[model samples]
Every structure is written in C-alpha cells, then in structure tokens.
Target: MRRALNIKNKLSFIDGNISKPTDSFDPLFTPWEYCNDMIIDWIQHSIGFEHRLTIAHADIATNVWTDLRERFSIQNAPRIFQLTKAISSLVQNADSVSVYYNTLKSYWDELEIYEPMPLCTCGSVKTLTDYNHRTKVMQFLMRLLRLYSGSGSSI
Candidate 1:
C-alpha cells in the first residue's frame, strides 16, 4: 500500500510532509488537492468495511492512513514475541525438506515486512544487505538436520 502511494508521489500527503498552499490562488494548490483526493480514494477502496467506518470521519488521507498503521502494523512486543516463538518452535515434523524450508521462509518474509531493512544514507546498504544475507544463510544451514547437512568441506 505504501509502495503504491510512493509510486504515485502521494506518500507526502499521508506522511504529513506536504504543506498545503496558503492561498487558493497558488498554482500548486489544485494539483496538491487532486493528489490528496486520489490518495484518500485509494485508501478507502483498499481497506475493509470495519476499518473504513473507523476512519470515515477523517478529513484527510493522512489521518486515515496513520490510524490504519497504528492499528495494523506489528510494532508491538506481543507481535514480535509471537513471530519469534513461531521461528523457535519450527521443525521438519512430517514435511519434506523443501516444504519445511518454504514454511520457514514464509515466517522470515513476514518478519521482514514488519521489520524492514533500513536504506543506508552512508552508501553501506549493499554491505549491510550482504551481511544480512550471509547471516540468514548460516542460520538456515544451522537449523538443518545433521543427516541432510552432508559434509562441511563441501561448503
């Protein structure tokens, strides 16, 4: 949702980073208003009925988006704990190696969505990403059963 808004260059409206023109005579005012309307419409159509009713009285897209984020985003400790618990409890069980890995990957993907990697302003994002990648690979290898691990020399 945020990616869609950002692609349309309407994220500023929802983030409160865009300033409204003081006068109706301002040339950018109309375009700004139009963008805001487009964002609000997109948000309304995207959300569920219960969510819509909660933010129905909101005069701007920013408020609606903010409220939705506050409600849905997993920034709380309980959500984090739950995800970590799932990761800790995961096992091969009856599933094949490929299926088990995929199941684990799904949890990691969701966790990534909740805890996104930061875009480094210091031009170290590539280095950071590579490090994160290696860490995840090592973690996955470590979780695999010894019977399937084959030989360490092969690595």
Candidate 2:
C-alpha cells in the first residue's frame, strides 16, 4: 500500500534547490528547519540516506518510540511487528526498523563526536489524532525491544 507522507517535517527546500544551513544540530521536538552542522547535512546529502548504515537507525527509531510512548502504552508481538514495519518503511525504505537504526549507527560512528548532531526527523504525527497508524507501529517497536532485551518481559 502507498504510505502516508511525512507532511510536517518535509524538507523546507522549495523548487528542489536550496543551500545548506551552517548548523547541523536539530532542535528538540521541532522539525528540521535547517542544519548548520555540515556532517549531518553531508550524511543526508553525500550518503544519500539519513542513516549511516543498518546500525544507525537507533536515533530515528528511539525518537519515534519516545514520541508515541508519551501518550499511550505500548503493546506486544506480531501485531507490533506489523506496526513497526509500516512505520519503518514510512520513515525510509528500510527492510526493518533494526536495519534502519543500524544503518544510522554506521553513519554516526564515522562522524567525529565533537559536535551535536541530529538524526533524520520525520516530523510529528501527534496532531493526526484521527489516525492510529503511528501508535500501532510504536507498540510494535516496544515489543521488539522487550523481546530482544528481555527486560520488559516477565519470566
């Protein structure tokens, strides 16, 4: 099925052309207006992906989860997988959320840590109260994490 567009954080560039901003760090809870931080832009520009590699998807995944968790409780497996897959693809063309995060890790690892860097922002769907697609995906991520880590599970 065709995915919904990330309307809120869609790149601000108009007419398909705009110069990069000087700052690369992104503001918390805000759409990425512009980045003065060269490396973040470079990753998005030169690498052709917001993620560095499969491992680097953490930044984006974590943020997405955190956003959802603020409102509702997360759910468990299978159903969660479905949700995650949808959200993951919606964010980028990743095979899975894990792959996406790892990809980002790969890119981030290559960068120097001297400066604060922001991950790819997909914008807020919190306002889209009419739909629960985002919430479903977030619940799936929480289950995947719990299953893998065994921390949220009871014996």
State the local distance difference test value for candidate 2. 0.37
Off by over 4 Å in 2: 1-90, 113-155
Per-candidate Cα lDDT values, in order, are: 0.78, 0.37
Q: How do the residues 7-118 of candidate 1 rate in per-residue lDDT, one tens digit apiece?
A: 9777889899986777999999898778877787889889887777776666677877878888877576777678778877777667777987798788788888788899
What's each prediction's TM-score?
Answer: 0.59, 0.16
**Model 2: per-residue Cα lDDT over 33-124, one tens digit each:** 33213223333344325334532433333233233344223334454555445545443243465775555444333321322233435544
Best by TM-score: 1
Candidate 1: lDDT of 121? 90
For candidate 2, the per-residue lDDT at 100 reads: 55
- Give me the candidate number with maximum lDDT: 1
